[model samples]
Target: MIYLDNAATSLKKPQGVIDAVVSAIQHSGNAGRGSSETALQASRTIFQARQALNQLINGHDPRQIVFTHNATESLNTVIKGIFNKGDHVISTVMEHNSVLRPLYELEEKGVELTLLSINDTGTIDPEAVNNAIQANTKGMVITHASNVTGDINPIKKISHLLHQHQLLCIVDASQTIGSIPIDVRDLDVDILCFTGHKGLLGPQGTGGIYIRPGISIQPLKSGGTGIDTFSHHQPIDYPSRLEAGTLNSHGIAGLYAGVSYLLDFGVDKIRDYERELLNFFYQELITIPSIKIYGHFDSNVDRCAILSINIGNIDSAIIVEELIDRAEIITRGGGHCAPLMHEALGTREQGVVRFSLSHYTSKEDLLTAVKCLKDIPKDLN
Candidate 1:
């Protein structure tokens, strides 16, 4: 099958990632649970993953990184843990449900929310973010890039504006973590959440959160951390405070190998390769009549390797199924968990077919997919 939905999860992973997971499952023990050799191996692997992520994001300290099941859990932990009844938080319409639903839950409980809107270019204006701040504004949770439109947000510019107002800046980097280079210090974000299965090319059930120094978030889960067992409350530390229960040591082992591979392979090279494929697909697909592509394709802009489109008001689900039956091509359709974005783009009813590329995607794959897409309108009539 030709997999084009890398935004959901990566079907292709490096050999090192596979080998590491298998080795961990066979020999590793629970991390921070015991001091045996097996347990020590698990602990070391988890720490190594933290170190790699810290290096990748240019973070201040490795210990501040905390592991979670996915970006959803991480975002929930931060969104729910940070704000209270009267505090206000800022975000954008471009957010995934992972960010929106948690904020919505808070809104019901008296927390104020302000979602900035996007312009014709399918991107948010930093000035709008500055204008959204209120007296009770506590922080902002912004996505690094839009999963639906592939429009990259100027996070650093927005974060700088947020800091001037003394508001906390939290980022959901789920779409651009490994695909784009992010320096947390440069971005000036207080917390950054990411998943390993997408751009990191790790297995599912692996993700993490990074909390900057001097910033404190209440623990989302509190239980055994293997230390301070006698304490009634969770340990007052960076990771242990956030991490509870048994850790996913095996998945983290794979994540470590994935990050290491990316470090050696160079993220820039991966970005360039994926952009080449996206450009080729866009250039060919734009030539077809009755096709409406989403997001701006300005030559000066740098965006994610995602293309969302519609074929003459055709139901996105039907179009996706047709591609699958005709060429075994896999793509994502429907709302993509971004109801606000779909509403902003006026595609709530029809939904758009999303084609997300990976480094593993090739020119030949795009050529075939484009050919199939070109034939779709003819087949329908």
Candidate 2:
């Protein structure tokens, strides 16, 4: 099957990633739980994974990389950890549910939320963010890229703006981390959350967050941190303060390998190739008379290798299912777990079929998929 649903989770992982996980399960034990060889191996694996992630994002300290089950958990840790009652926070309508649900819950607990509107093309004005700042405004939490529109935000510019005002800058980098050349220090992002399963090319259940220096947040949970058992409160340290139980050592082993592969191949090469493939597919899509594509299709723009479209008024889920059944094309449909973005596009009801391309996607496969979608208008009738 032609796998185009990579935005959800990259179904195609490198052989190194698979091999690392298998090795970890075979030889590694609970990290930091014992003095045995297996336990030591597990501990080393987690440490190395943290190091890889640190280099991947050019973070300040490897110690600040807090691993979690997924981006949702990582985002939750940051959202619940930092904000408090009556704190005014700025966000955007292009956020995925991972950021939305947590912010909504915080709103119930008294955090004020101001969602900034984006243009029809999914681009937000950096000036609007500056205009929204108030006395009580604690900071801004923004997505590095729109999962629906594949639009890259000017985070470096926005981060500079927020820092000028001494406000916090939290970035949800779930869709951009591995695909985009993101350096925590260069971007000046105070808190950045990401998932390893997507662009990282790692296994599922692996994600993390980065918190910059001179910043503190409440722990989302408290438990044994493999050190200082005598302390009553969570350890006042970088990762130990946020990490509550045994880490996902095996998954981290895979993540370590996955990120290393990315480094070896180079993120720039991967990004450019994927963008070329997206342009190739889009060239075919734009010619379809009945197709209405969402978001701007600019090859020069640095966006994710993703495209969303609809043929006539057909239900997107139906199109997605048909592609899987008849065309053997794997894709994502519906609101894409991004209701606010769907509402913004006026596709909340009809939804839109999404094609999240990957580095592994082939030209032949893309042509076949485009041909199938081109015939969709005929099939609908």
Candidate 3:
């Protein structure tokens, strides 16, 4: 199948990723729990993953990054741990359920929440965010890019404004981490959540959070963290404090390889290639009057390679099925876990047929998708 679901989880991983994961499972033992040769190898793999992550994001220290099951978990850990009752927070309507749900739960507990509205183009105004801050506002959480609309947010501007207010900034970079360039130091983000499988091209169950120094968070799950075994209390370190369970050595090994591949190719190169594909798709799809495309159509937006659209009179599910069954093309449909974004875009009822591209997607694949979309009957009754 010609997979177009990179935003969900990249299907075509770098060759090194698969090899590294398999090699780790075959040769290495449990990491950080023992001193055996196999265990040492596993520990090295985990270390390399952290190192790769640091290099990818320009993080301060590798140890400050904590591996989690996925971006959702990382977001929840930060949202629930950092904000207490009576604290106020700011988020955008473009946020996925991952960020929205935690903040919603906090709202019930008297944590004031302000969901800033976005324009129809899915762009959040940084000035509006600055206006929303109050005396009790402790943090501002925002997604780097809309999972549904692929609209890139002005994170740097938001960061600057939030810093001026002495409020923490938490960014969910699930859609933008590997696809776009990000420097944690440059962004001044307190907590950054990212998924490995989406942009990083790693296996599923691999993701992480980068916690800036001076930000303390309670652990989501307290358990054996290899360190502080003698003491009953969890270690009060950057990663160890938040990471309270055995690491996902195999997935992390794959993530390291994927990141290494990106490093060698350069993130700019990947982004440029993907932008070419997105621009081509956008230009071509707009010619069809029956199709309604979402997101910032301008290529200058520096957006992700995700496109959300719908053909007139065709249900999104049926379009997805046709793409898969008739064209041998795979794409995603429905809200994409960003119901707020879909609602904002007026696509909640039918959702949107999403064709998310990757660096691996070729001109031929785009042509094939375009041909299929053009051929589909506009009247689906």
Candidate 4:
């Protein structure tokens, strides 16, 4: 089967990642829980993973990197913990449900929310964000890139504007983290949340958050942090403050290997390869007049390797089913979890079929997918 749903998760991981997880499962124990050799091994693996991720994002310190189950958990920890009632926050229509649901929950509890809409090019304008700021506006929560459209937002520009107003900037980097280069210092983001399973090529349970120094977020969860078992409240330290209970050390070990592979191979090289595949597929698929593609596709622009399209008012699921049955090509269809983006694109009812590529996605895979799409309407009839 030709897999093209990498935006959801990386099905093909590096060999080093597989080896690391196996070794960790065999030898590692609970981190920070004891002084045994196995426990120490677990602690060291987690620390190495933290350092690798910190370097990947050019973070200030490794301790600021807090481990969570996935990007959704990291986003929830920041969103639910940072704001209080009466505080205003700004976001965009391109957000995933992970960002939107928590913000909606906060809005119901009296936090003011202003969700900025996307422009004709299916991208958010930073100036719109600047205009949305109110007297009570404390910060903006935004994605570095849209999951559905794969269009990148002007985060650095938005962050610069936020700095002028002294408002905090929180970025969801789930789509951009490993495929795109990110420097926390350059963006001046107060918090950055990411998942390991997508662009990072790590295990699904592995992900983290990077908090800029001096910003304190309330703990979304509280329990045994190994060192402060007697304390009623969670520890006030950097990682222990946010991290509670035993971490997924095996998955984190794999994540370290994944980051190491990216470092050695270089993220820029991988991005260029994936973009080649995306453009190749796009050029071929757009020849058919019945197909309508989404997102900005200027060759000069740099965006994630994602393409979403629809065929002549057909339901996205039906097209996906045909691809699966006829050619065994796997792609994601239906709503991509960004409800506002679908509404803006006038495709709320007919969700787009999303084809997300990774370095693992080959030129041959794109060829097969293009052929399948071109013949779909004929086969459906």
Candidate 4 has what TM-score? 0.98
TM-score of each: 0.99, 0.98, 0.98, 0.98
For model 2, the superposed segments whose C-alpha errors exceed 4 Å read none
lDDT of each: 0.93, 0.90, 0.89, 0.92
Q: Please, what are the lDDT tens digits per residue for candidate 4 over residues 335-369?
A: 88889989888889999999999998888888888
Over 4 Å off, model 3: 378-381
lDDT of 1 by residue, 320-339 (tens): 99999999999999999999
Worst 10 residues of 2 by lDDT: 119-128
Better of 2 and 3 by TM-score: 2
Cα lDDT for residue 225, model 1? Answer: 96
Per lDDT, what order, best first?
1, 4, 2, 3
The candidate that achieves the highest lDDT relative to the unseen native structure: 1
Please give the distance, in angstroms, between residue 263's alpha carbon in candidate 3 and its true position after superposition. Answer: 0.6
lDDT of model 3 at position 156? 88
Q: Please give, for residues 344-379, the per-residue lDDT of candidate 3 as tens digits.
A: 777879989999999999988988999888878553
